[model samples]
Target: MHDAGDAVSLLRDGVVLLGFGLVFVLLFRRLGLGATLGYLVAGAVVGPHVLGLVGDAESKIGVAELGITLLLFIVGLELNPSRLWRMKQEIFGLGLLQVVLCGIAISAVVLFATHSSVAAALALGLPLALSSTAQVLPMLQSAGRMRTPFGERAFSILLFQDLSIVPLITIVAVMSRNPADANGPPGWLLFIYTVLAVGGLIVAGRFILRPLFRIIGNMGEREMFVFAGLFTVIASAAIMEALGLSTALGAFVAGVMLADSPYRHELEADVEPFRSILLGLFFLAIGMMLDLHAIAERPLFVAGMALALIATKALIIFGIGMAFRMPWRGALALGLLLSQGGEFGFVLFAQAQNALLIKPEAASLFGAIITLSMATTPFLMTITRRIRAQPVDSSDREGPVADGANALIVGYGRFGQTVAQMLIAQGIPVTLIDTDIEMIDVASGFGAKVYYGDGTRLDLLRQAGAAEAELIMFCTDGDQLSAELIDGVHESFPKAAIFVRAFDRRSLLKLKDAHVDGVVREVMESAVKMARLAMKSIGIDDSEINRSEEHYRARDKERLKAQYETGDLRAARDRIITQDARPDTGLGGGGK
Candidate 1:
């Protein structure tokens, strides 16, 4: 407890965490488990109860709290209201349905099993209604479901859960009956505090933070922008606390208001390093706090509680998914996805313990249960993989009628639009096949010849005259699927020339692997166009133009390869630009 001893204890804690984190990272890589799961496991190992290295586990919870705030800020940056409003039915109706139904069902089960009061049951159930956005979204993106119907449904539910935590906290605070003066404030007062805190933060973010960010953006200083983002988080959290509301709510509100701000993406990119480290520390603190001894001592009781918790929550989520007419497999997937208690559970559980909604022993039991359930979710997902492996059965539309079209555009994305427009201007009859309804709708409004169907769907492609078209363009983005389409088009229509769009170098390699007639890197094409314009501005002429372009492309590809290999993009960019600008360098004999 002495000053020197405290310093040594802190150093030991850091050492414990460093060792634990590295081991978990290696294990996670081998297991193909995500880094977040690895972080949690690392926290558990080095936590106070396991090794006593963290020493007084509760102390670091504050830093973990800040990490959650930063996470919410980043999440807020992802949600733009105009875009959100476009999915109002899903966000409002289905989202609210998922939260309320899940909460009520789980609360009822808990009440019956524990003989707890309705209010106490509600307090426990509210947290279970939330799914882990951090854990789920990245996986969904990796699965290529970010824009899919199922992904949108999952996203809406997660967003609602985040918003609902505010009300849940207030309700628990008001309903608890224990200590004489436990009636901290009136419900109306809490409501007032919540509204003022949220509204004021939004106003500040818009009028103040937005302008400040614009000024900092003009400075073009990455470090300064990072500092400004941190300032926003801390300031919002402080304001929320001052107003007797949750700091998480304030941070989220700040994020939502800045969702459409010009510099939102820039702020996110700059703030990432800080957010990442803080979040890692947070997970480490969580691990260090775990009382594994307690879990072992009451193994049967804790195991029973954890099982009951997951079962109750899963059943509720599954039933809701079914009622929404989600396929059986999708329902099972949804059930498993939300079986664990999320981050908000910690907040509410702590509050409930303080408010005497349950005894300290019960709170400890709940905490252990939450941790166990979370730890098991990844394995549960793996077990249900077979159920999710079934192919989606969307009804196929007859592709564009085999017509007088000589050229065919297979995708209607940014690259496809440019290609289609230019072809149309040149009086080429181009038929478009795209699966996106929104894109098809927009194209229809502009009187563009577009088919509303998946290009990769063989029937649709054949019906669209793939066998007869003079030219076939595989401008779609998926890797294997796009390659399949190219192969199918080539096999079915041997005479048609194939032009494909490559998403990245790997995709370019895949296209080359498939031996597509011509492949263009969609993003690099834009960069090359800009480079050509710059070269022209500098009085570069026809004799040197092709050589200069080729040199830039080769240098750019090398730089990208180096960046990917080393995970140090800034250094690679610097090397590329420095090498390119040198006059002594030969651009393959083009006046270098």
Candidate 2:
């Protein structure tokens, strides 16, 4: 039923979009830049302003909007009520200050530079206040910092920004409304309507969605569950749109409603592909909308504005981190990680333009600035990391005096703390070494004799009396670092019995290769304990369970030793299974 020209246009758009998108992504990835930036460049290259290969930017915008909706939905899914409650300080305090301060600062700058009205400056500044969650979060995860103090704080602030979108969108809509319409409904009446609409949606979600999903899930068709989830989002978005509320806000509420459901992860898995593709399309559309001609005309001015915005955001974030008593290094890292403008800026600018809050030209210019800021994020974070890694003054390195302690502990984290506590309970004098100064200071407050230094440093280890210590234990969460430490210590202090806390089987093997005196897998003992419980629950006698556990442990140790010596885990595992399957031996029967 579609026109032949329209069909041709669709085909051409898909081919160009995918073709350019793939090449740019590969190239950007190779350069250590992210895929989001790659997609943006692809869109710009194929857009009418450049090659004129794709002129359907207007048509693509609707599809791109779906991406934002799904993104908000996923954000909602992540933010269960309990998590928000737990992170209230960072979300409300740090997040609020970041937005308000950044907004005011950027607004003043815009007003001074462009001589724009207060409302226009504010419209520009508020969206610029946000940092890119989609970009920064993945970068943090890849760097293995998500469990660190800095990462937790960063996540909390980003979460608050995502939640703020609901009110921000509402404010923009109210501002965009005509004065003539304002005369029709009193402000109090509108407030009541908004409250009632939100309450009604929550109620519907609690009652209607749970039962609907249960039924769909019972049917056991994965596609049906996906369909139902999409239906819920679209339907809720429609209702909110009709009620003069933000569709994203509505979709978010729907996601939270199902957050406690058993199918939450399933729903997330089902919707992820759609969310990712749509979000990419959204970024691509923004890319297509870039006014490259404007940039060419005033390159210095545009670049200056972008740099100014990043500087403002970084300063404000650093100030907030300092106010919260974070170390200077941590504050600097936080500032650098979140200096970029967010994906939400695109959404806000589009909405603002639609609401007549900003002109098309202003929107175009701001969009370009945000895109550039986002593209610079990876480099900024890398620089911050390098700065953080620089060696500190030796005078700052204070630690517990070795004092001839027989045992030296490296990495006073959760695992190390437990081991240290048990040793201390028996009146054992211990020297603990950790690189995290903050963590060491806190542990010191709890009467722990913790040292602040990189445990892997040979001089630091020597200072901690590693050469004289009877036992040296590596209890850090970092598997590679633990293996490296074991290797170094074994080479330098062969008399010290090195016992390592391996994170998994792979780490255990690595530690074994390092010729450590003992390698205790972090999870193996707990797994064995649980297996004992499982056996008892199935009517096995306690004595039998104990015998079985002992037999299994001995056999596993023998197998591990054989695998280490032969460097053939697969063959060792096959031989063990073959021995266990035989009926004659008591140990083999118990093993099976």
Q: Residue-pair clashes per candidate, as listed? A: 4, 0
User: What would the TM-score be for candidate 2 when compared with the true structure?
Assistant: 0.82
lDDT of 1 by residue, 87-147 (tens): 8877787779878877887777678767888878887777767766666776678776777
Best by lDDT: 2
lDDT of 2 by residue, 1-592 (tens): 5798888879888888889988998898787677788888899999988998888787798987888888888888887778888888988999999888987898898888779877777778888988888788888888877876788999988988888888778767677745544554565766776778778878998888888888888889899999998998888788877766678988888787877778889989999999988888887888898878877777776788899999999999999999999888788888888898888988898888777778877887888888789878788876667676635555766754658988888889888999988988998778898887667666868877677777777777787888888888888885765556667778898878888888876676666657678777888888889989998898888878887777777777788888778766654673353543742336324443
Indicate the worst ten consecutive residues by lDDT in candidate 2: 583-592
The regions of model 1 sitting more than 4 angstroms off are: 1-5, 29-33, 75-79, 176-183, 193-224, 256-260, 297-315, 318-332, 375-524, 536-547, 550-592
RMSD of 2: 4.5
In order of appearance, the predictions have TM-scores of 0.75, 0.82
